[model samples]
Target chain A: MTQPAIELDGVGKRYWKIQERSLLRSLVRFGPPNKTELWALRDANLLVEPGETIGIVGRNGAGKSTLLRLLAGVSRPTTGTVTTRGRIAPLLSVGVGFHQEMTGRENIYVNGMLLGFGKSRIDTLFDEIVEFADLADFIDTPVKFYSSGMYMRLGFSVAMHVEPDVLLVDEVLAVGDIGFRIRSLDRMREMHRSGTAVVFVSHWLQAVQLLCPRAVCMHRGQIVFDGPTEGALARHHELLTSDADSAEYARGTVRVENRQLLKLDGSPAGTVQQDSAMIYRVELHFDESVESPQVLFQVYAEDGTFVYQMQTPLGESWRTLSAGAIATLDVTFLPRFGGGGTFRNVVVVTSIDTSVTYVRDDGLAYFVEPRIGAAGLSDLEAKIAIDGVDRTESRPMRFGGTWAAVEGA
Target chain B: MNNRSLLISLAQKEFRVRYKRAWLGVIWSIALPIFQSAVMVFIFSRVGRFGSGSSFNYAAFVLAGMVPWLYLSASVASSTTSIVDASDITVKIAFPRAILPLVSPVANLFTLAISVLILFIALPIVGASVGPRFLFVLPAAVLLCAFTATLGLALGALYVYFRDVKFMVQAVLLVWIYITPIVYPPSALKGAAPWLDFNPLTGIVGLFQRAVGAPVPSVRALLVSVATTLVLGVVAIRAHHRHDRLFVDLL
Candidate 1:
């Protein structure tokens, strides 16, 4: 019967979009200023137990930041209630309240206090923060001179040392060098293991999948889906593709329809195994007559990294399509993604010279199971030997495995 | 208690950062008021002759008035925009937004203290002896700070909603010094001296002048100053309590 670390009960935040704020105009006019209410978040109800790590996935303007702000207690919800227990540390972007002229050592004390840490507590944790940030050399230098990466590292380092009961992170994981990024992830994992509740918001779905067992997907200021990370990401992609469809429709040209990722036997591919061949099938409806149309196939990792791309060779004539013609296209390829994760397959139909893109379809999103013990974008099938003993796990670790198992294997 | 420490640390940061790059550092805190006081003494003693008929040392009187005036002007100007200037932190972290506007006044305390010290030292050199009445300076300083802080807090909240408050504050400060009996004694206004009592600063500044042996201001003026501070303090506290979390929305 322990209290949830964080709770949101029918919470909503509304912002008034005021057209203009002028003293004279307000005094002269009898009524209030012209304004529209924008609900950044609405009817959100959530409960997170201690030690739970939950991810939030959504497109831009989807209320992720609004939810984080609420959880951090930075803004009050216009309706309902948001309750968080114990100390809440928000690792927002870069340094908050960091004065440019202040040295790193000074900023640490100031920033730490702003996070509700006392002076004596900061004194005890100062060295650890500096060491973690790897800014021992620049600790005395003003922050204005530090690089953006250095600034972010310092900010992140301080928040981690706070040992907060509830941690709300917003897009801060994407900064810093690769080494720091890995160290941060490790620090977050350590915090997770220590029973801190974490609410992580990120567009980096791969990181989300690696860290969070559960996730909430948001769209248009509402929670569209809340469940496992896999299902949330699937829902997110559906919204993204649907949004793309409307944008394409506005262009008024060839329309890509009925896109599907199917196994060799033509059944819908739920989860394709590593190196397994699959076919991306789609139909193209042309509004006007066109010469030999070119096809471009692209694959993107869940984090939006462009994995691979192929296009029709120049000067190759497949066939001409007349007005109102319907053509079926099938692209076959082996999913060679390493450390398998969810991926998106996009198909673009363009003119022969590749100058005019008639339609771009991003409908087919599928998961690839990585080879045993394999991780990363491409499965190079890397093997390991330690002191003349084979150390690689025979059963390769697949995508969506537990974080600890992935690290241990 | 935690928030108290936060306020102190933020004020410390503001104090340190302001002088970090300045070549003169904190000396400017003492020097700026002395320089301004000297200029006023020169102009009024010769050009206007307003202090010729006064019984007290005009230099000390001007310096006394300058101490509170400078603190009020600087603190109010900065505190009025404190919340908006700190949008970076306000939009992310949660804390008492009142601390933001209060920091400027608290941070300027160093300067206020330095200016007051300079005034005490100049009093004897200008033939104005330090009397036990100078004890009034203590309560005077406290009231001055309270008034500035409360005003700053209320205006800081207002500025978040209407940016015009910044310019309005600046415009008011420009005309405020003249009407506050800072440069000229209330007696200089003759029959209009009673009207000057309506200005809240008349009572606070009169305390400083009284410390230097000038005639005490009307009792009504002191009440006016106290009442204004109390009212502004209540308005400020209420505004912050209601809008502390909501300020981030506008930010």
Candidate 2:
């Protein structure tokens, strides 16, 4: 492996919170007064070897952005030290630093220089950057007119062509379309293969899993887990679902006082296999009386898009569930979602109308790392036949669309 | 081979694209101040309100002042907001923060050059004799540009943190021309002449007027202008060096 391209030893950043803006009036306010203190990022540490692609995953306000900003040199750490070996390029949030009045060609030069290239070097690489952006015709036009996709294309092209020793990517790939995203990821992968130390920050666990073999998970300005991508993801899921203490208590006509995933023999199965049938047992504590309660549960894909939802029998009438009555509900489904990423399970207890929910829990996110080469949301068994030859499909079934044989009407 | 060429290629690219859409093409740079000079010449000649003296043509007087004033105002106004305005690229990519401020002054050089050319063309028409004294405007132009960029870089950095700086700059520029002796002669100040020496712009305008053989400024005022330019330039560079990479965070 190449030498360590980026190193941080006990590096931490502290920001001041001004009690009030230092405006003329505010500064002269009664007796020179206001308070300020340090917040966010203290005593953080990490080291990255050259050619290593590392993913950083965390919830909102987790200081993930703070860490990325430090890596990019956007802001310096208030304490500790950061040392980098060579030219560093940051592909931050989409199309940063582009001047609206400037054309694509002009921006590329300006951008290339900003990334630490001298003028002559940029001239030689100019064509490559332009070609990568696919903006041959629009290169001379003002970037204000370029669509978001074009802008991103140009930005990434310039960054990649700079041949940076260390590349910092911050959730910018989330904005592009699928094709562009694929290309950008391919370029990033190529960079990794060519010995560029990479640090990528994203909320998408799937994206993290796809690009980074090694990953770290952050929570509340602290590194919760740091290891292999798969292990980090598993720990992240455990943190999300091990609701020993969750503030988001279920609220509905019947409040879910407790919920647990269990094995077939009535033992709690905290983690389930990707292909095994499992039972999700929930206990609802009722406050007021109700006629019928429709308990709903949903599983979400890594990107937070809904995977599927199920409801209990709708028409079953129940006697008034008085206050202080504890009822148990169980749901069993074969774990079939195909893609190997984190999936969140949410349970909501509602009235028969399904409009006024008494208990709702959206915090329990689960991780499902499907077998290798599998894809999409589900693993439904199916076969394709062409000219009497059956094509046994190996990939998992992605969400949406289906094929079938139908007799003539 | 590829690395050193980026700066030259970018500067050329920016210069070419700036005038790509104009009707008169690159001539628009010269045309703007020349037209303004024509209007000033007509108004002052007919009205005789600018305290004209026999030594210098009022037409040439106004053109000289307009040249530096245009360069200073345009450079400062644009440079103050250059980084913030180019936020699209600054926030995403890693680059030297100085490039944003650098682009404006570099681009404005074209117009500054045009104004100087027009200054010469207007000189003979306005009854002024041209001589080696014309070379004096070169140093004066250089000094003026140096100061303008210094102010631009400094103000641009402040602008990233304090958004109100842009409006404050506009407000100052609105009142700046009157104080600079651009439209009228410095002698008109009379009793207030001593205080006028303290104003940095007075020396610059005095230098331009001197090139045209107008009443040359006192030595102290000229020294003050040169000193202010050097001081402001130093301050701007120091501030930018310290805050260059961090500017994007505030932006």
Q: Which digits, one per residue and each the tens of the lDDT, describe model 1 over residues B93-160?
A: 88889889999999999888888788888888888899898888898999899899899999999999
What residue runs in model 2 are displaced by over 4 Å at the alpha carbon? A1-3, A18-38, A100-103, A135-147, A174-186, A239-253, A261-273, A302-304, A318-320, A352-356, A370-374, A381-409, B1-25, B45-48
Model 2 whole-model lDDT (C-alpha atoms): 0.75
| Best model number under DockQ | 1
With a 3 Å backbone cut-off (N, CA, C), the pairs that clash in candidate 1 are: A338-A379, A372-A396, A373-A396, A373-A397
Name the Cα RMSD for model 2.
6.2
TM-score of each: 0.93, 0.88
Give the least accurate 10-residue stretch of model 2 chain A, judged by summed lDDT: A399-408
Q: Superpose all Cα atoms of candidate 1 onto the true structure and report the RMSD in Å to 1 decimal.
A: 2.9
Q: What would you estimate as the lDDT of candidate 1?
A: 0.86
The worst-scoring run of ten residues by lDDT in candidate 1 chain A lies at A395-404
Model 1: share of real contacts kept: 0.86
The count of backbone overlaps in candidate 2 is 30
- The whole-model lDDT of each prediction reads 0.86, 0.75
